[model samples]
Target: MKQKKSSQSIRWIIEVFLFIVAIVIFFGGLNHFWMRPVNSDLSKGNSQSRLTQKKFNYVAIGDSLTEGVGDRTAQGGFVPLLAHNIDDSYDVQVKSQNFGVSGNTSTQIYKRVTTDNKIQEAIKKADLITITVGGNDVMKVIRTQLANLSEKSFQAPAKAYQKQITDLFDYIRQYNPNVKVYVVGIYNPFYLNFPDIKQMQDVIDNWNNATKATVDKQKKMYFVPINDLLYQGLDGNEGVTEKTETSHTITNNALFEEDHFHPNNIGYQVMSDAITKAYKEHVNEK
Candidate 1:
């Protein structure tokens, strides 16, 4: 009886070990497939400085959207285009440095503002600092909640979002008080609606308003409503249809990268135009 009991106990231990191995294999595979890309992007952005120090007139900073996820043109990105356009139009020697990275959120920018030596130098020297952030934060939340909750259910996180925005702006202001800061708001990606697109739109709108409120509290800080420029009706304006020549509307071919989140070439052009317009206005103010 003792030997039989021992054999049974050994068999049970083997089964438990096999079960644990199977669970690990299942979860490991899931992480490898689902989480790898996100992890890779985060790692790449957090690693090092890709931007060259050329003493640019303008510096663009933020996440993947600002990193030129779209745009097939090989001439760097929209920052170069905007600089060249400004140069050609205003007859000024305009140079730009792009400090954007893929998959960064406001938190990352906040960290970069505090830690990045190159960014600190650029901020001190730059005449214009245009930034596009907060999208990744909102996107990450949406992606996480989409599995179980309705898009509208994501609205409850507004307070947390506001805190992040406030913290990000506070960090930027603490770093450079006099720098011309333009905070681009988040734009809606789910315009076509697989789920509650309207709720997502509302969430983004509230986020933008929160950003604007932060900008309003600071001197020399401006909130550029790029989301409105892209998503027209969100601000009570007529929606731009395909007939509209505005660069805001994404052509089917110019979709973002594999993540289906960032902008393509056409989208980048729209963003460049918005930045150009804001910069021109800023210059005129001075």
Candidate 2:
């Protein structure tokens, strides 16, 4: 009888040990699957800005877009908006300096980045640097080639722009090798008025592509494309990408009414949001 009681107790203890092991294995598997980190591709879709939890110095250097040309709010265009966005998203203070020239060309921007002392100091201090160039460079070519406009007309200029960017970025890296640099691309504000001229958009595409390619060749450099993003109406409706020559006059709701060239306040918001998305998606731990 005593021998039978000992056997029963031993069996009960073994059963309890197995149950505990099973429970631990089940929870361990659940934790592994639930807490797995994703590190492959953060560049595809919208990603919530990770909490940086630190202060950063932001430097804005580019063209009219950087100058807040058409912003009715009188605030510095995307620079301030982006500062505010980063401040909110990362829970850190953003001290931004705007070095955007109203109509600076790529060559002009290169000159400043290479020679200007103030911009050099800013670049040295910047944790994030955003560049808005190439739009005026594209416009320069368009103005000179409007009479005989074709895709080939932009080839040489595009190459020159690419070289300038390469050299410009090279110079920037010489001083601030590790600072993250984001370059904003050009867009076709004329697409609405001249839908028949497919080559017009082609020229713009060529410039943007050249700029993106140049940026791709460098480390810690990124391109923020705004061409297609600006094609949508402020109402979230599709803008006229496919317009016939006979199509009625379509206005880009995001563009400023006064100039129909620069982005309005809402347009600046769009730019800032796009910047935030790209920054969050590609930002590495620092």
Candidate 3:
């Protein structure tokens, strides 16, 4: 009876050991076949490096301006121009991706950056990023209050626009904290067309000011003021102010395309010049 009891005890110990070994193998196989591949794909999707080995990566985002809506060049708008210049001046190859959706509001742009996996990946890899938002946000308010325009009318939209701007930067930083961001200030496209509406000028200025303040607080971000570059002095506001004077003639109806809303090729050239100048100056300082 004693021998039989000892034999049974030894068999029970072997069964317990086998159970533990089976558990370990099951988890190991699950990780190797399922979990590891999922993790690897996520890393590749978010990788900042572009194919074919470029020296610099640029990501441009914003509204119609970003889309180069008025640009006659089939080659995209100011982004391509800026990319070319950067390549020549810096003597480095640049891979550029423009994620501009025509007529996009700040809120829409926020959604795109957060949800669009392709855009998120491009932004993550960007060495330099340029954003031109808030224009459509301003336009939305202007359209609503066209007849009943007032300084007070702008206050509400400005507040809302600020919130969207805050959210935009937040999303960008979440993806890539170290990339340089240049927030292109909104130009008064309506200044020449609707000069009599003095409140419009005030609205544009307020929007630019809000953007400047927001960008000032963050490192590796800058506010590129194109207001002065595009300002042609409408409705007796001011003829021209030489903030950062450019040689290009920005005024004249020819600068605007047929729509009278977007800039023509020459006008886009002026914008490209302003952005490139700002970039060069800022980079030199560093």
Candidate 4:
């Protein structure tokens, strides 16, 4: 009986040891198959040596969006915000040159690139550049044809816009052979005021497509679409509101209440986020 008892005790100890070994093996396989790939992908996505550089220089040239027209803070809209984001995320010192002008059309911007010596110098030294054009170009066409507007009215202008954009890209490349360019797409801020005008959104979509097509032709150019980002105002966040005890009153409502044409503070934040994400993804894809 004593021998039989001792034999059973040894058997129990071996079974316990094997159970622990099985658990360890199962977890080891899980980590090998799952954890390693995740880590590898994160590293691969931003493995570019330049991205890891300690000092980053960002240059922004475009229209009011880059100028921060509607931003109450007067901090140069998405330009400063984007610089701040890059500073924190990449662990680098970002020196940004913002040359955003209000109500400047694509042609005007093209002209700036062609003539402005300061802008040219900035572009040459820039590690990264962001552009906010094509918005005023689209708006100009709309205002001209509003009396007899139709979807077809945009067709002719969009072609010209495309060429102008192509030229813009080519000129930038002329200055800097390797710096990446991010061109922001235009959105319809008038959608809320004129929801009945279904064709307006269509026109915006067409313009955005044209802008994206232009982006695709260049070597390292990327398009950041913020058309849907501002649409969230449709829910409860529409614009600035004044809450009253007696009445739920909306005194002023806009991503840009000052003009209802440009983006407000929140609007700029969304734009910066989108730009950052696009920048990261574009770099990764190349």
Candidate 5:
């Protein structure tokens, strides 16, 4: 009886060991066959290096707008669309790299151009450079003040705005003297007003005018007035309505992200179209 009991105990141990071994193999196979590839694809989708190849002809530099804040598709931001459009329109093999970071202002970009090795290299190789900045600088300050007071109380700092704009232009010229610079004007975000929002629109107009002046002063630079493109009636007779928000205006949502400032997918496409059109015009003029 004792010998039989010992033999049964040994068999039970073997069975338990086999069960654990089978579980390990099952999970290992699942990961290798299924989960691994999904993870790899996601990583590739978010990879920044994939945006531009070495020595691209066109380069986009600025804040979240340039980074494709509004685009939901992972295929890439407007930079890719701009590149493809340029190729089709100009019949030139144009490649583009986007060096945009969320919440970055002109000051940040100025520092980046000098200190960031990757950006420096991209600027050196690029024949065309597009920028969308100064919006964040103005918006951030306005939002902070508006949080506690009425919209009428909001006033933009003229001196600070001038300095930032000047510094950004100076930095770009100092970095690459020959590269064509296209400065994008700020889009109107207060079309659908909460309260005291019209003042925000006025501030945006001033900021855009400053940007235009700088571009006008430079020989190789041009200002792409996206504000005019997105907002209907450049005569300032009407503001963007909620009905036209999806196609023409930016909204306060995740599509626009938490900031309620950046463009969603639709917004990014509009920007891409404007830049592509400008590039085509420039090529034609040449």
Candidate 6:
């Protein structure tokens, strides 16, 4: 009877152990797939403004490029680089706050601006705002219509992007009425690599044109073009290929990082330059 009882207790322990394992797996999967926290990590830098008492606050907002994803240096991508370039060139005390979250679409950024307290606070105090979005919005359409390509593939997404982008600009203006808003245009990551997928370039350009139109109607908002700088001359329909760095040359897509989705360090630097130049031009106009 004692031996029988011992066996039953062992079975109960095994069952309890399995139950705990199941619970762990359940919650783990839940968090992994669904429960991602929606907050941008706020990082503040550059104290030269403190010493000089100038106090120029620059806030960068948007997706992974704004978060500095492909920058191997991990220096928070083009946001910080733009800040440093502006301060160094202009000789002004600038404080840069990066509120960029990777994989965030235009709608997500609009939500962050309206909902996230930290991001809202930064925007409130920002002297300038640089936004890089609409890339993921375009990507969503591409992914859903991978096997099928058409002229109408991006029409819906582009319209959705226009609304979200308009709301984003409105939110920024609501928070910081006087600050300069620079909207970065999306580049075609697949342009040089997937020449056959000619629809992507048109999709990107259409989205960018929509974005430019939105920004043009708003006061203190400027659209910065980075698409032309990233992979120029690919024209989508051109059945052309260029030699890549690798001996196994595939296509002329030399601007993208190893992921072939995001920009490389060079690409990000070019982005920084473009934004900085725009900012300088804006400053001169002011």
lDDT of 1 at 126: 72
Cα RMSD (Å) per model? Answer: 14.8, 26.9, 26.4, 25.8, 21.2, 15.2
In order, candidate lDDTs are: 0.60, 0.73, 0.68, 0.72, 0.60, 0.70
TM-score of each: 0.67, 0.76, 0.72, 0.75, 0.66, 0.76
Candidate 5 C-alpha lDDT tens digits along 141-190: 54454333323332445456667767776766776878877888887654
Candidate 4 whole-model C-alpha lDDT, 0 to 1:
0.72
Best by lDDT: 2
True-structure lDDT of candidate 5: 0.60
Candidate 5 clash pair list:
70-263, 70-264, 70-265, 254-257
Give the range where candidate 3 is weakest over 10 consecutive residues by summed lDDT.
34-43
Clashes of each: 3, 0, 1, 2, 4, 1
Query: Per-residue lDDT for 207 in model 2?
Result: 79
lDDT of 2 by residue, 1-286 (tens): 9999566545543443443354345434432221111111112122343333455788888877887777776557888888877777766656788887666798988988788898898888888889999878876775566445456778999998898888999988988999998999888776454444455576777778878888999988999998877867577664634448775666778887655567888889899999989999877745
Worst 10 residues of 4 by lDDT: 33-42
Question: Candidate 3 at 7: error in angstroms?
Answer: 99
**lDDT accuracy of residue 11 in candidate 6:** 51
Q: What lDDT does candidate 5 reach at residue 128? A: 80
lDDT of 6 by residue, 106-169 (tens): 8888888898898888889888888989877765664566444354867887887888888888
Off by over 4 Å in 5: 1-56, 143-156, 193-196, 232-260, 284-286
Who is ahead in TM-score, 3 or 6? 6
